[model samples]
Target: MNVEAPWRGNNLARQIVVLSALSFMIIAAVIGAGAFGNTAVEDQQDGALSTNGSYLAPAGPAFSIWSVIYLGLIAYAIWQALPRQRTNRRQRALGWLIALTMTLNGLWLVTARFGTLFLTVVVIVLLLAALGWTFRVAVRTREPRGGVVDSILIDGVTGLHLGWVTLATVANTAAWLTTIAPASWEKAADAIGIGVLVVVGLIGLAIAWQSSWRLTPALALAWGLSWLAVERFGGEPRSTGIGVMAIIVAAFVLLPPAVIRILRLLRPSVD
Candidate 1:
């Protein structure tokens, strides 16, 4: 049996996808290659991280997650370049949103560089929303026997994207507030930061349960949270409670699927 996606021949999807790649590349260049001589994101943490120095943030090394995420996206870019994938059900649904995300990525970098913390938060929020929609669409369009390509391109790529952006949005919001709000709000900042971490951990639980614990996004979240734990628990300016909370949240986010799979394996199979 042969399945062909009608949208495969659609030029608009291809164009938007290509445009997204260009925008993503720009984001990379700005963040890493010093395009416009901008400082790397980790180095430019002054606007947010350096200012607030929140206990909820991960240590510097944890951010290397971006490199892996970029690699996944590049794999996706190449997959889309194939004529067969142009009209892919998942691709058709996800292409525009992916492009939108890349555009937002660049916008966030600009806002960060200019010290527009509020706008940076706004852009990342939109970016997270776009990725959420993309994930929803990917789930709706999923077909059985979708195989490795489908899993990798549709769920894997989008899941990793969504997970990372979710984590980023929290950090961005914290940064925004810390940069703008008066120092008198320091306690409130800590409360809100910890609150956001809790909420994100719950979101992770939902994703894991919904996906039956598909591992990629959870892994991504865990990676960031683990770093947060390191920062709070082990590093300077530390808070043992927040660091412990990060550890628990990370573990909670990763637990459901493992539990479910164990149950499934224990249940007797039908002949």
Candidate 2:
């Protein structure tokens, strides 16, 4: 009569173990960005991953968001291992993908630390794709009854991960290009930078639309873009035009989702 429950129970045990180990690996890797005898990504590649490395790079301070995300991942790992979460349908649906993301996070960092710039870009793009798929799955799955905690731990983390990686993918591509592209490309850097920001804004909007205007992703994306704006406006190799475009694009990507969220809160049936 309830064979599904037993199956889920058995499967969740294995998932919990696997997820916990992956989470540990990811936490160490995130921390290893600066400590445990490892150098920061910005400092690793002869500073090629620094704020000044690419036109699309976010300012140095923007990276502080990594701490919050790392904490979120750690929290999620613990939360999902709890007995109450063991047989949860949402967790069952999302557990493996979430684990995949954590694994990818570690892999991306390792590639950045020891592999070539091209490998770094490849791993990050794959990480972004995995996060995007995870986000889609999260949106499609209905949270269980009284699942507010699940919403925060799973959906929220996935959204933030996907959003941050989206912008990171762009910056990583730009950094890789800088290493390989012609020096003459610098002449058109301004134009190319603005074009890239425009595309980033569109991608943000698409994700928001797909996820019913989820706020966490927009917040993370805007956070990265705002820092890029700050860097372009005040940091080395400044471009007032790119700075202004970044601000505009940040607002552009952020406002619609915010407005839609507000509308839904007020009307409660807008969707």
lDDT of 1 by residue, 1-271 (tens): 3343444446455655656765666665556435667676655656355412554567877777777766676677776767666555556666667767666766777666665556777888988888877776676664442478877866887788787777777776766665667878765644666777789899988877666566677777888888888887677556776777788888888676556656677873511
Candidate 2 weakest lDDT stretch, 10 residues? 23-32
The per-model lDDT (C-alpha) reads 0.69, 0.85
**Which residue pairs overlap in candidate 2's backbone?**
none
* Predicted structure 1: clash tally: 2
* Model 2 per-residue lDDT tens digits across residues 45-134: 777789999899999898888878878888888777777777777877888888888888888777788888999899999899999999
Model 1, which residues run further than 4 Å from truth?
1-9, 12-16, 19-36, 45-47, 50-52, 142-146, 188-192, 261-271
Alpha-carbon shift of residue 6 in model 1 (angstroms): 10
TM-score of each: 0.83, 0.93
